[model samples]
Target: MSWRRALKDTARSGIAVEKKRLEPLIAVRGAAGLAIVIALSLWLFGPAAAASSAFGAFQAAIATFQRSWRPRPELAIASGTSLAVSTFLGYLTISKEPLFLALLVVWTFAAGMSWAAGPTIGLIASSNVAIMLVTVTLPTSVAQAAGHAAMMIVGGLVQAALIVLFPVRRWGAHRDALADALAAEADYARRLRHDPVASFDPQPLMEARNAAAVTPRQARRRPAELHGARGIAERIRPVLASLADPAMGVPAEGPARDRVRELLASAAALLDAAAHAIRHGEPVKVPPAALATFRTPDTGSILAGAPYRAMTRLNTLLQDVVETAGGAPQDGAPSGARGTARSAETDDRSTSGRAPTHPGARGTARPAPTTRSRPTFLALIPKALKAMRSELRRGSPVTRHATRVSAVAATGYILGTWLPLGHGYWAPLTSVMVMRPDFSQTYSRAVARLAGTVIGVAVATGAVQAASPGTLLSGALAVASAALMYLLMRTGQFATQACIAAYVVFLLGMGGEEWTQTVPERVLLTLMGGFLAMLAYAVYPAWETPRLRTRLADWLAAQGTYAAAVFGSYADPSASNAPDVRQALLTARTARAAWHAAVARATAEPVRHRGLSRTAADDAEDALAQLGRVAMLLEAHLPERGATPVPPAARFADALRESTHQGAKAIRERRVPTWDAVREALDAWETENPENADKVVRNTATLVLDTLTELSEALDTAVPPMTLDGTAPEKPDGPRNPKDSATR
Candidate 1:
């Protein structure tokens, strides 16, 4: 985590190109929108107006490319409206430097704080601030500024209209997200056949859940196949794990193990077929081999008890998947109508009780009909305000980022104006474009921005010199550059920035700037702006390394609650506990995702990993993963509602919850958790009705205790007393070097 190593990694990441499939059709649509705006403006208002209008179209096109579940036209319209408002307000203050600078600070700060909502919102908001800096200077009078602002709105409307008319792969992102989740489960099932204890990443499932959240209007128009399948896919993961796990009593090497392998392989095939169908809108094709494996009976077989029950549930869920994937009827109802009901029944059966003695029996508690709803666009205004208010605290990263960006923007503008640069706004524009909330992004973007600007400016300059293109040709070239930008949008920052630079160059040429004057000034101002951004981050940084322990503690606490909820559901198989269990699982997944992201960001920071070393962190994460897996196995074999309730499980659940809450507090204070309460509860249970409890519950309790022990031992390595500066205190033996065992 030294500065030199961090710099090397960030630089490499800055230039790395992602191998994403290019959506040429979508690119063509966006370019056509831009072309329409430019051609109309050139015919009516000339090149100056065309140049100003292109910003709206170009920005709206970029907004469509963001990873969001919202409608694409909505995104374009929102981006255009916001950019237009900023430009008009910016024009009002352009006559007074102090007022304009004050407005710049407020706008940029608001843009930075928008990260609290999500990256998509933050990036679009930031682009508005940057574009505002340039667009405000395009008009010379109040009347002219009003015209420019009106044209900006027109540009956005045109882009939105084009998207509505010629849609490319509508809801394509949602399909891919849901399909990826199922595909991930399919991959996990295959891996478990060989390595029973293999860990599965929950990121895909999390993304699928996000994609599934829909507005009421969207729900009415959604594809039939996209509904309810994700919930089934979630249930399949644990069943696959439990059946293959040797701890669940499947013999390591026997006919039973062989049969389990066949079931897993068959499940994988079915899932793959379902994924392909959903992703590409093709018909689901069931493989003959998979159908045969599912039909294999457990009669006269070595697999019995827990394994037998898991086999039954797996077959039932896969049937649901097949039925749902093919848009077929389930129990004489259309898949769309019965999808939620079947998924709810499926989850209730999995967690509420054991599989029915026969397929005809149902769980005691039935889930009410439900619909997924998300905040409407209007509702988001208050939600965004609340998020911004929460981020106003001193410790919030968003607040720090806002302050940093505001200061850098004002400084860049003042320096630009004082240094006699013809276009002073380009300096602040570059800074706003490159600065981010984290150290790695801020530095990497600075590098990428400078490099891209140099290449883009040079290439455009050479072209202009060779072609000596007039205003009309310049407008065409700008549109072409925009098309290229859209094509390379997802590739990497370096390539996107290069295209943006070229687009800006030709765009300005339409406004009658000579290539000789514009190109050199842009390159020099961009370099200066990038340098200021990098320096500002180094002076006032929000390093993720210091927050690694906090993130880890949060994950530990969430995992404990999830395990408790699973046990509670078994102790009392009420419909209420079912939702609690589902909610706990979701909370744990979110925490785990946050922890992983923190670790990834911290790896490129120059600070020491505050409390946890690299090896200790890995060990701790593994132990937590095992804890979740054990809970999942127990969940797969929950008892029937009328069956005997394990009363002792209720007490153990409370004990686990309290113990982990305390343990998390200890973690934040840089101490190893003793887990005394959990150990005592286990001992009391073992001493009191050890023989009366279900064998599966007893065995799973022991496994949970073992994982907790592993966790405590792993954290012991990170318990060394440390100074405020993230370095270990001197001991009798020696002082620990931060570089030797870094947290990342």
Candidate 2:
């Protein structure tokens, strides 16, 4: 049903759903490329060295998937270096068990703890696996070990070739994120049209924002382009939220409502166009009539004041989006407004500073892409050393996780070596592969690893029985199987390559003298490895249950800060508060991202000896999500009080201040606090300033009140104490889900 809906939506949207359609084909093409590389290498090296070269192909395939999301040039560098380094380390350590073991502990510890530094560091650590494998081949001949390690590099080169020669659309992730944000806007618009009284969830839009910011690879290669789109996306969030405010009366009904919805739909279409434009480097075009209503709003409709304000902001932002996306003025925005918006965008770009190491992917472009000098290798050494020191500091997640991973790997290796299967490498391999920083990912991957093993074993055994494909065919098939795994890796279907990996493993082993005894031993070893990884995590968690509540508090404080900023902005927009607003939003985004990470851990966490149950944790997550929308609404519809006389700004500023404090206090105290002060402030403001209480101001006050009430309910919902034994202490733990009581 979802697929059918997706198809219908794609057809309705008029743009080709190319990414969704091309994933499988990309997988096949990438696999084919890797296979060709391996096949050619095997031919050159001969069957005597097939196993060695096949290992290279395996590494290359894994590296290809790891680096695939990045731009072509960066992918080449990272993937190439990773393969070479791991292979070099792998070969150098062979026949030296003590050295191999030492390297294993150090590398695994480094990899597990590397998350402290950042994404790129973390990626390098997690993906480098040759060192561990090299340890397993202890007591092997130097020539044989070197040959296999060298093959890995050759395999990586093949994968790189495929990316360079037949690259799929670059910036698919960025495009998808932009599309998602636009979709979110459209959904919000539709929801406002139907029911403005109900609370909304900002999670979808937040997820989109998070995805774009998750990596900065695109930023490095094309900061000017990608950041411009990101800037537009971020800037538009407030405007959309404002549109949702009932006070804005964007489209209560009639032609005005239709025009508003039409504009929103067109905005979504514009996003689609921008996405395609980024990929193809073409000018983004929109229907000339698309945002006509937004460009020139109704004169005497319900959109007189607030909607007019919305329409004006929309004009500014839409023009800015088109300009940054290298799009044209096809949306029929006034020429004067387009120029103004472009200048505004440039001003933002000029003032926005770049991030350390990687720049922010905020979707807002600066006046220009500054020519900041890239840090040289020597320059980065100090920072890298500093980061290492920080990670090794007592009780850091990185340090704790690293120590845990090292211990587990050592234990797994010892157990494997003691088992007499001579394939003990499988245990440590599984242990290293499965153990990650977060319990959720660790457990999930453990399940995937085990499931994939079972499936791969079954499929490989059947293939072996079905066809004796001879030496050449088996070797080629092995490379192809490795390629397939890399190809399907990014699809998030972890099991997609299980069968292929299994096929490669079985096929590679078949060439050896002990071929008959290989499959069963491998199956057993794989299971052992999976069990060990899962158990290690259970014994020593990288993050505790209490951290979940701590993260939630962080999010609560973040929203409180944002709300306070929004309130202050509403009270006095002319004041130099732009930096405060921007910083507040950024802080909130960071906090939200952290909370999201914590929630993910909670989900993947072992259910026993934890903080809140899944249901309670989920409720807390939902509450925060709802609160985010309200906070955003404040930012969006915050009435400018400098030049224009927004009487409501003065009326609700104190109320908002009180509410923000109360809400944060409630979240921390684990109790629902009364918002009597907010109501009192509102009452006093309205009573003292009756003449200022125009319909618009009154509606605005009502909106703020609704938000506070929702905030109160959110804290109340999660405030109830939860038992550790999975039983409810008092009432049924919160709601079954946050949405059950969504309508505050």
Candidate 3:
């Protein structure tokens, strides 16, 4: 490769990195409106007035940032409180450097660690760095400090007003969430086309659904998008799994196969169409006659019996999606967006496994349990503080991250004080913002921050030169620059950092700070901060990937407990404890969430030290997902309607309990577990009766055990698959499934 060619390749790669979207017309108008407002304000108000108002305007601009799709009162309050408190702290400590710098370290640490509390609190804590710079070092008097604080509060209020008035970005994130989920389902459908009968992993699409659910959903879009996609997929997965079972003896590559293939392809197309419509904000456009394929016996039709039952349900789900696009809940449907979704995954989780969670494979679930009442507004403070205290006590990764951030930021603060720069606070601010709990995120931010600062400094200098007619012109230019910054902020972290740098430059320039002086100082301080943050991470980092194996072990242990608790419910439906079952599910969900988060962080970790290969990691993650699926099924499935409630047989119940016990022991002890009663029961059930519904339940139970066994063996923790009641143990070093022996 020639040097010139290499350079060209590098340039091309850089350009391709940013996937620019065609901005919606409304979005463009919103940006223009913001620019005009800022420019006009500066032109009308003198520089002092404009600069003072900016403390409000800048914050207002940021209020409409990532995932802030709705009017969240708690968020508004949190933001206001953070800004006020941070500014007050700065004002109090400006003349007391030793005290302030020490507090800065502690404050930053808390901010960094607050990520454990979820996105909302984390955003609030992140405001501390901004206050440290804009409030603490700059505020000259008590009156000025109070005045600036009031103005900033007003700015946040203004942003909230704008949101209500314009409503341009309403449900934008919600729309994307639905579109992404549908698109992921479509992709999964495509994969299924090649292997119509085989049991492929459903983790990727499952994950997309999980992520979509985690977002703040609009109440209106919830019912259609929530349970509809994941619920339908979960329902369909087992139908395919059961159909693929060799015990059923359904021939491959027949008329049924061809019909199933067309249905799957059509399902994929339908999902694609829905995804397109949601993303473009158009009504779902699918033929109502599309249902006729399942409704009538046609060419290449497999519409009969259980498959037909599933097919009809699929049609109903499609109708639900279309209705969602049209707006509001249809007749006989659950109200609210996530209400039905809350039950979606939990229902039919055990359909693939008859672990007593769903022996008859019935997928209907009771309504979601009512949530605890919301605390009064004042109670939020105590609740948040209590959460903080609890988070600190746990010697978990969140605690460690908080400690790292505090130490690094404090060091940066001290450095700023020692160094001679026009605006030394930028160093500590950079340190605080650049260092993140996520290792990959931290590194990326550091790089972006540096590049953005350099670019911003240059841009600010040029703008100042071009627009410096007087104070009014200077202030107007600054406001215009701020609007430009807002336009680019969410485009990418790199773009955001660049815009922030320019915004700050232009903002200070309105206060009569010369571009030549402020630009160099700003760039230098930013570079120092970025460098310091990177160095700190290199010295004392918490790598999630290295700890993934341990987290997986914890997940497996939790799964064992969850499975045991759920199976106990199956043993005697009359004795089933709803609260206990719910608790077990919540535990499993927590464990599952933790393991997935760890896997994500590990994948994003530096390649040389990422620990696990992507393939191995994905397999582990998928196995965990399968376990969660079974757990969900157990929670959602209920006893058959009007049937005499007979207890699950001792043989079945004992095997389940023992299997779960051994699985847990293996994960904790790092020894492979051997099956005994489980194998015996499966063998007896499969061979004894071939044409009973009870036999199907036993087969499902066996399938679930087989999957768990495979998962355990994959981790090299399984001893063998042998009868625990005196049969010679067959030890296998690698993973294997129980033989599909179906002799009738």
TM-scores of all predicted structures: 0.94, 0.77, 0.78
Error of 2 at 734 (Å): 23
In model 3, which runs have C-alpha deviations exceeding 4 angstroms? Answer: 1-17, 20-49, 68-77, 197-250, 269-284, 298-305, 324-383, 466-469, 557-590, 606-619, 622-639, 643-665, 668-693, 717-744
Backbone clashes for every candidate come to 0, 13, 8
Candidate 1 residue-wise lDDT, 1-744, digit = tens = 898998888888787778889999999999999999989888888888889889998999999999999888888988988899999999999899999999999999999999998898999999999999988988888888888888888888888999999989888998999899989999999999999888999899889888888888888898877876877788788888899999988988989999989889999998999999999988788887886786765522768888887887777777777777774443422223343335442342234233343334433234543456678877887998899999999889999999999999999999999987688888899999999999999888888898889999989998998999999899889989999989988999999999999999999999898888778889999998999888888999988888888998999999999899888866775335665777788888899999999988888899887678888899999999999999888877766555577777888899999888888887887866766677677777778785845667877887888788788778878768544455765554432222223334
Local error of candidate 3 at 98, Å?
A: 2.0
Clashes of 1: 0
Query: How well does candidate 3 match the true structure in TM-score terms?
Result: 0.78
| Candidate order (TM-score) | 1, 3, 2
* Candidates 1 and 3, the one with greater lDDT: 1
Poorly placed runs, candidate 1 (over 4 Å): 298-300, 327-341, 344-365, 721-744
Better of 1 and 2 by lDDT: 1
In model 3, the Cα lDDT at residue 340 comes to 32
* Deviation (Å) of 138 in candidate 3: 2.9
Global lDDT of each candidate: 0.83, 0.57, 0.57
